[model samples]
Target chain A: MGKYYKTTPWVIPELPQSLKNIFKKNGKKISIRKNQVISGNDETALFSNTEKLIYIDSGLLGQAYKTYCVNKPYAMSIVLPGRMVNYLHYLEIDNSGDIILALRKSDIFTMTKSQFDGITEKDLKDEMVRYCKKAVTSDFDAMCCMFTCDTPQRLAYFLKALAESFYDDISTMPLVEIPLKLSYAEMSYIMHTTIRTIERLLPKWRSMGYISTRRNSLIIYK
Target chain B: MGKYYKTTPWVIPELPQSLKNIFKKNGKKISIRKNQVISGNDETALFSNTEKLIYIDSGLLGQAYKTYCVNKPYAMSIVLPGRMVNYLHYLEIDNSGDIILALRKSDIFTMTKSQFDGITEKDLKDEMVRYCKKAVTSDFDAMCCMFTCDTPQRLAYFLKALAESFYDDISTMPLVEIPLKLSYAEMSYIMHTTIRTIERLLPKWRSMGYISTRRNSLIIYK
Candidate 1:
């Protein structure tokens, strides 16, 4: 299981800026500051508006789902820049689905299904499909890790995934120092464990010379 | 967590035999016997041809993936009739992806992506997309259970899910005894625990007046 835990997710290329720029221009671009929470609920609309397809252009979006015991919900997973958050549907009036919070100062844009469907141009639609397919594969890999690997193995798998998400072609490069600019608290959220537990395991990994932590970021040698 | 573990998956209506019959007519139907393993490999084909959308019409299909220490691959989860298996992609020529086994005498049909995408008629395409969306939500619920719940909670969740999968509208009836036709061995495989552990747990549930085993099947009272 030594090399099995080292399983890295398939590399996903960043969505082309040209296509994303069109979304930014045509749709709503919401900027969320680090550590800020975006409640799905709006005061005027009694229902949580989940009608938009979200594109993460920058920073991290942590999806916090409520647990029975914990007073504060922890993030079960993360979405990095170039990742798309789609395909989740919650009950119509219920407030219990996902609470999207910015793990970092993030910028995200939303496109409605109608807007997506209205694109009659074949070329643009084909390009969009290609990008969406990439996101789907990334989702599949993350999900495979979630279902199959042990917890520590899951953490290791995701750290490498997060690094690769940040750097487009980090997987192809020779042994190099890749800076993973995510905090331990965020890592805790991702792993669904306490920050203290992450602290214990991370240093054990560092002592074993498998990885290193630098200040707020991690130096992941791939 | 008591009420929480009683979490029943939202009822999925059996794919209308009307629609499924259409799939059966257009695609190749393969019958797999109980306990029979279908290696993706054919004698001559060097590559595992995963280029099909499998629609299960009846019986159970258990997907087993090899673990590091185990000599026999244990099923991680199950696919009941009305469940559609899509969106998994294995590496080309790699035999390490999935080992599909019939948990019962199962009949499944496959439709190529080309066959799926070739439907240009608006009404038929719309119906197929709606059915596909329903399948996606079922996948989502199952995934949420996997990621968020504890082991016992997950087991409880899946048992209710399995019962509902076997009988449509099982969720609607009050205090009904729903028959779950899966065996303890299959339950052990699904939970990634030993059959001994399942034997230990089921009797405890029985003592608590929660469930009862009848021959090889289970009677789940909801």
Candidate 2:
């Protein structure tokens, strides 16, 4: 077993008063309740206690805070609303039935009763199960592939994923500011340790050049 | 200042043979003499040891082996033969005379003879100098404006630069393994500190669910 050692972070020490003043003028604070979902697909910015460009706090059921929300890949059935058309609607008879049932209930359906009665949920569920199993397998493979990857390899992969989500040219994209929305307590929860343990680890990673933290902002190393 | 403490990496008492195989199969033994140029654009893979995926050794003049070659940016004037194009390029011009001279020497001319002859080194150099000063200033302002960046930010920047030279997205592209060619000594020199440090730190990150490492592979918590 390798020995574990603590190291001090390399800090610039004492920021100029001007820099402090700038933060005071621009910084804002927000408080998120336990179990409160900070940002979702429709949400943009959310303020959190302690000022930062971004902050995430997990109060319960997960990491307290300080986790990066990278884009997660989904299966074909998980079509983006208003963005892509779902082929599964036509592929699964049961799902088509749900659509017809809803339409009929709304008193807007023109289809004959026979047309609406032909759908079955069993086939739709079976396809969905298969898709979900495939998704799990894909995730497993991805994790395994990353198992041997170095920091540079991991960073490149993260960047590529972000590029696909943001609609940008990955090759030319500049380094972007990734927001952290987790607090120390939340991070401890996710780490499955005490807050004290997290407090200890933070500075070590800082010193090792893996991450940078300011007031509330934590910038992940590329 | 934040308190810094390092956590010992958690070691599994018995690693699965499948996982251990990664380390066993990829490691190679080799060495690079001091001041030796490990690899260049024209050379084969960057490392000298081609047999193993992982080469760990020791030597001097490591910096020479560290350089990476990337495609030049759009305004391909000052970009070294290889380096990621940072925002810095857009803001500065260190020299223009060399560009003008090179242009004059090239048989593949894009400008009219009169226009080509009108170009002068002094004009080019002056423009570049002006651009450079502005770029440096802009870089600082941008840092302060966008985020309260610090040393970790700087380190991440450095790593990214280093990675640009080494990282290749082989998964999506046609690849016959990586042409990874590193001497055992060179590879060891590159990772000696990191491996020890990471080995010590892995347990903490694992506890936090941030990373998982076994033998030759590492899985990053997304």
Location of the lowest summed lDDT over 10 successive residues in candidate 2 chain B = B3-12
Candidate No. with top DockQ = 1
A37-86: candidate 1 lDDT, tens digit per residue: 65444343212436666777888776555444353354356765765554
The sequence of per-residue lDDT tens digits that candidate 1 reaches over residues B138-212 is 444555555556667767777777665665566566544544466778777666667887788888888988787
- Label model 2 with its docking quality class: incorrect
TM-score of every prediction relative to native:
0.79, 0.22
How does model 2 score by TM-score?
0.22
What's the C-alpha lDDT at position A116 in model 1? Answer: 63
Runs of candidate 1 with Cα error greater than 4 angstroms are A1-13, A39-49, A65-74, A87-96, A116-120, A168-175, B1-13, B38-49, B64-75, B82-84, B87-99, B116-121, B167-175
Error of 1 at B220 (Å): 2.0
- In candidate 2, stretches whose alpha carbon ends up further than 4 angstroms from where it belongs are A1-15, A23-222, B1-33, B36-169, B172-174, B193-222
